[model samples]
Target: MPKFLIVGATKFEIQPLLTYFKIPVHSPEGLFSTESGPDISALITGVGMVNTAFALGRYSHNLFDYIINAGVCGAINKDLKIGEIVNVTNDTLSEMGAEDDSEFIKYPDLNLPGTNYYENQVQIISSALNGLRKVSGITVNTVHGNEQSIAKVRRLYEADVETMEGAAFFRGCSRLSENYFQLRAVSNYVEKRDKSKWQMPLAIENLNSFLISLIEELEK
Candidate 1:
């Protein structure tokens, strides 16, 4: 049996996955253990890159055949409405490079002074999610809203979605097993923070449907 891992920023992101897979939630770490449904596991690491990297790295060591970092992200492409899913093809920490004078430095790929990315597993994961709805992801430490940062990222990486944890999780998995994936469901746009504009509830509902299909596909 191939052990599968699922890491998310919060319980809400992993709730549909857990329920659909019938995995019991473990507190403190939100690690769910199961023997059925692709032999998958789930964890709800708190928010941010540091916690997400640590939680996923610790949980993924020598234990899983495949690791999935699944969660909610802010969409940049207006075409992707809230509740749509985005398959991360590759992740880059959009805000990692150094800034000098007035120009932002472009550090070598996967060579950020303090960050990480899994180059090997990215395409493999992308292949698995190939036919699914997708948009490239660029992870950022800061909660983005300004048009300036959005333009920079769009120009630099050509990413359609901006997320907080995908790059961190991918970086953490670099030394671990080689099969890792990331999927994000858009809950809101990377715009002015407006609670009324957030589609969290709808995103969760859509996530439930996505997980059901994903599990079925992976099973076969």
Candidate 2:
């Protein structure tokens, strides 16, 4: 059976899947069998890149056949409605380079020490992922809440979504496995701070729902 690792920034974000697999909250890390599907495990890496990197380091990557980074994200495109799930096919650390007064220079232009952007190398993990919108995303140290910064990022990356951990998760996976991908549900638009407009609950619910479907497809 294909062993899988489901990585999330927090347990609540992935609670539905954990419950679906009948995997308890505290012991989702080790290999488990559900009596009907492949062996699976999960990791609740705390928020942000640093925590994710460190959390991933605690495990042996060689044991899993697939790794899926799951979370909620802010949409850059107005068309991507709240609670809609999308596959982040590519991601980059948006703040990895310095600002040249007015124009921002990317890592490639600055000749950085390590890669700043990554594309999904994993071809297929589950057929359930085939029909979702494939989108480009940018990872940020601070989520955009200002109009000026949001516009600048829109012009710079042309990204469909923004998240705190996607790129870091991608980078970590680059060294750990070749069979991994990220999936995110839109929680809100990348606009000024407006907690009233955010739909975090819906995003989490939708994200876990899709993950459950994906796991079912993997069982077949």
**Best prediction by lDDT:** 2
Candidate 2 structure, TM-score to reference = 0.91
Over the stretch 33-120, how does candidate 2's per-residue lDDT look in tens digits? 3454458778888888888878787775456777899999999989998999999999998988888898898888987577889889
Which 10 consecutive positions of candidate 2 have the poorest summed lDDT? 28-37
Residue 60 lDDT in model 2? 53
Q: How many backbone clashes does candidate 1 have?
A: 0
Every model's TM-score: 0.84, 0.91
Q: Stretches of candidate 2 above 4 Å error?
A: 27-38
Scored against the true structure, residue 18 in model 2 reaches a CA lDDT of 81
Q: How accurate locally, in lDDT, is each candidate?
A: 0.73, 0.85
What's the true lDDT of residue 4 in model 1? 71
Residue-level lDDT tens digits of model 1 in 22-61: 8887575657777654688777788888889788666654
